[model samples]
Target: MDVRTGLFYLFSVVLLFAAFRVITARNPVYAALYLVLTFFRASGIWLLLRAEFPAITLVLVYVGAVMVLFLFVVMMLDIDVDALRAGFWKHFPIAASVGALIALEMAAVLMGGFRASEEPRALPGVAAAAQAGVQFSNTKELGKLLYSEYLYPLEIAAVLLLVAIIAAIALTLRHRKDSKQFDPAQAVRVRASDRLQVIKVAPTRPAAPPAAPDTPAAETK
Candidate 1:
């Protein structure tokens, strides 16, 4: 096999192994790390397809932002491994059934690969267009579809994501007694006198000597 084909197989094998580990690993952190490895392998496959934009986007978005956030959450949270696994056997039958169904669906989808025809090469006119200084890019085609045909769908997706973000914030938010909140309107309306206080006091003075009774003074003398 050629170098490209060899690399593709190599990446695909590693990607599958990593993906399996992500599901089967005992440690959550290890599973997350394996997932990161899977993303990297997928990016490599994208690069092999000459889709630079998708490869870079996978690295920057999933590996950089989403995976880091996941890792941070996993590490920072307290999780009980034994307690988590205690009910695994109880849930395994259903989980396995669902997993099998998904696997079958994926297999059915991928089976089409054996029958799908290869994409035709560029037409003579298209080749001439390339020679005439028109740059060819899959990213350009993707951008055109995203902006023109998929624009409304994309906007709706963005709005849904935004709503989901707001909902998550609302759900996870706790009203902690220790957390002090400020009123912006009250702060803006405050004057110097309202913010600052001054206390007045008398100047320092020496204590007066106590006067003794007349009989006690005579006895001292």
Candidate 2:
């Protein structure tokens, strides 16, 4: 086996392990961290396949941004692992069956890849483009297909993800007795006049009042 095949196997194994841990880890923070590992491994696999765009995107977008955000949120929230695991065993059998079904489907797909004919039928456009001495680029082809054929589905997926992010933010906005909230509406409405008041008062005389006008002072006078 060559270095590339060895690297592929290494990354694949690690990726599968990380993915399993992501689902089964008791600690949410650990689960999220494992997910980051999974992304890294998957990115390595993409790199091995000469898919630079997807590899970089997986590393930069998921591992760098999304998974980091997940880790931060998981850590900050201090979620109870025990509570999360409370009914896990009760649900495990069903989850396991579903997992098995997915695994079998994946196995079928992978086996079919091995059974594919050594020669693939060629498309005229791709063949003509190749013959024209244009540099072969999977990334360019991916971009073309994504923007043309899969554009609508890609856009819908993006909108769904945006909605999910908004929903998570909304969920985290639960009223906390210790949390302080600043209403932008109230803040914007507050004027400098309301924030500060300046009152002018007549200066008091340095001398004491004239012995209260009467009493002992009037008698002495």
Candidate 3:
């Protein structure tokens, strides 16, 4: 077998194993680590496919940023493994049946195209340009395509992701009674005189000592 095919098979096997471990691992942290491994393998496969930009993005964005955050969150959470496993058997049959159904459906869909002879043709502009010696400068092409064709959808997706991030932060962050939180707007509006206050009080003189108690002879007299 060729080197590329050998590498592809190796990566595929590792990807599958890591994906399975992600679900089956008892420890949440281990599962997260396995997921990171899966991402790495997938990125490797993408690199082999000559999708360099997406491959690098997969590593930098998913493996570097998302998976690291996932690892941290998983480590922080106090997962109850026993509780998670308690209903495994009870749910196994239904889960298995659903999984089987999905597998069958996917198989049917994938196999459906096997008998088809014709493939869809690329657009004339794209095909003609590709046929010519014109090679796209990666970043420029990506920027042009993103801004021209997919701009609205990309912006909307970005805004949605930003909203989701804000929601997650709000949900996970708790306000403590001892924590001091300052609002910039409120601070900016405060006056120096309002922040400082002083009061003067007069001092009182000490009272004279009480007279000595009378003796018993003085009381008899």
The lDDT for every candidate, in the order shown, is 0.91, 0.87, 0.87
Clashing pairs in 1: none
- The residue pairs that clash in candidate 2, if any, are none
Candidate 1 vs candidate 2: the TM-score winner is 1
Report clashes for each candidate as comma-separated counts: 0, 0, 0
Q: On residues 93-156, what C-alpha lDDT tens digit does candidate 2 reach at each position?
A: 9999998999899998878656657565456656877899876677788899999999999999
Model 3: per-residue lDDT, tens digit, 69-134? 988887888878999899999999999999999999999988855657857565555577688967
lDDT of 1 by residue, 103-176 (tens): 99999997776565865477564587689988667777778879999999999999999999999987656467
**RMSD each, Å:** 8.0, 9.6, 8.5
Residue-pair clashes, model 3: 0
| Model 3: how far residue 19 lies from native, Å | 1.1
Worst 10 residues of 3 by lDDT: 133-142
So what's the TM-score on candidate 3? 0.65
